[model samples]
Target: MCVLIKKYKHINTNNYNVLENALTYDIQRIENDLKKNHNSDYFLIINDEGRLGKMRKIQRINYIPSIIFLSEIELLIEDSLPKASKNSRFIQILDTISYIVYLYCLEHFNNSRWANRVRNKLNFEDVINLLDKIKNNSNIQASRTNSYGIVHYPR
Candidate 1:
């Protein structure tokens, strides 16, 4: 299973503590804590050892308080899929894909400073073309940060 462990950078604190070095120990702990309470194929470990203000981003996604939260997409599917009958999975998959696309667009637009340079000429069709370019290109994270930073485009 692919694991995405989100580790936060220490803020003002200077303590550098190493976590688990062995997979056996970690897997045992996860099994006892996660599998015992919840069913999941994969675990997303959210580490918030040092983050303070930055924790807001994580909290906003969950709408709850937690030092760490584990989510099982499959289990969530098992529970919520019935609401849409036969097409639930397809809809859910599409929604997930669309969100990824939106974030990719945001990352690209934020990086390019296209808003400032071409905002005057960018109509709805032009904006869609920008989205197409960002979606087509695979290497987006390494792109440059916008000189003017990020501005939310109004819907």
Candidate 2:
């Protein structure tokens, strides 16, 4: 079986930037700990070291499927509907897709920049195309810092 270790919080955030090599040692140590105790067949060790956030962007789409966050999605829409459907069916689908992408971004980081961007859009359909581009290509970490850098998400 594969072992998933969320080492980001487990490691002290204050030391992460200076502990790159230490993190590698920590991974091997975790693997050994798993093999010795938990599972001998722990062939894969997936570590989410938050410092190396950029590496996860491409692979996150494969693992961050929206099905698992169904309940969260429900809560998200509990009080939230665009005041304009108020528009077309196409607009609705695009809104749904953007919400899904926002949820995906939320998985990686706790920031609400994506939701805020959607909230602050000029019109109901303002950022549909931009949201589509962000869906599978970007991670929330990037979305947070690079807010103004992204297309259509201006300051």
lDDT of candidate 1 over 42-70, digit per residue (tens) = 44433223333333233223322122765
TM-score list, all predictions: 0.20, 0.20
Clashing pairs in 1: none
Number of residue pairs clashing in candidate 1, backbone atoms closer than 3 angstroms, sequence gap of 3 or more or interchain: 0
What RMSD does model 1 have?
A: 16.2
Q: Pick the candidate with the highest lDDT.
A: 2
Over 4 Å off, model 2? 1-83, 111-155
Error of 1 at 67 (Å): 20
